[model samples]
Target: MAHGEGSHNRNSVEAGLEARGAELTGRLIKVVLDGEALHRLSALQEADRTQAVADLEAENEFSPLSHPELESVLHLSIQEGRMVFDIRDSHETPLMAIVLAMGPFKMLIKDYQMLLDSYAGAIAEGREAKIQAIDMGRRGLHNEGAELMQARLEGKVMIDFPTARRLFTLVCALHQKL
Candidate 1:
């Protein structure tokens, strides 16, 4: 083959490849766009306003207590040996219905934080009457308590009688000097 002819043939092959690549790329882009459009349409259809309002009203009727108020309801449920359900069930008291129906996890977390604050306060006050060295020792102990409390808040620690008993002992012992 002639030198110029060889160069011309190579250029033609390269141009053909580029054209085919562009066409394939365009088709792939169109497929992605179609998928995204369908996803958006599905989301819009799912966001039905009337259904949302009805759901909101239903939830509201079940749980009239605010997030902060959930603790008392939980306590009541525990005392009564009742299993609380967010959905309608025969065993649900009005308090149980209200608490279980709202943002249960959020309210539980908020209540946990409040309880943690009280725990921290009890630790702080408990250490106040001790000598500085003993207080320091108690602070170290309290750091462990804090970590345990964090684990409890994260649902790693299950609330049980044994755990409560240990915690009560620690709190009582901490305050003895004060």
Candidate 2:
């Protein structure tokens, strides 16, 4: 019984160490949105642009446990009307780079923008019903964008729904800059 207990304890310690190693390697340490890609966002109305910047800087946790190859720093940019994801390790060595065509996202983004404009107008006009309806549409479009992003990234990277939503926001911010 004593020998069996010793073996079990050793196995537990080994498992703990493996888990810790995975945690350490499968975390995103930083995320950078390219300055050139952010130009469109800067063109937004002052208040809207400020809010967009704040949203980008908000705390975000990224876990690539499902795709261990992606456990690293991430940089986002837009090139030739496409969203580019450049992933790098802690040492700044490039891991993988993926470019997603912006075409598929155009309609959803446009709809979201329209909804935002409508919602703002409704707010200014003091129409609660219109605001609520527009808000619902905005959320629905946002979710759709996130789902499309997740689908586009399938097999390349794994991200949670909230992460996908935030990524969609970033994409919209970049689109605004354009």
Which pairs of residues have clashing backbones in candidate 1?
62-98, 63-98
Candidate 1 lDDT, 70-167, residue by residue in tens: 21111111112211322222233333231221222233333333444454565568754444544455444434443343233221112222222233
Which candidate leads the pack in TM-score?
2
TM-score of each: 0.21, 0.69
- Global lDDT of each model? 0.28, 0.64
Q: Encode model 2's per-residue lDDT on 101-127: one tens digit a residue.
A: 998999887877766677778888999
The CA lDDT at 175 in model 1 is 22
RMSD of each predicted structure: 26.8, 10.0
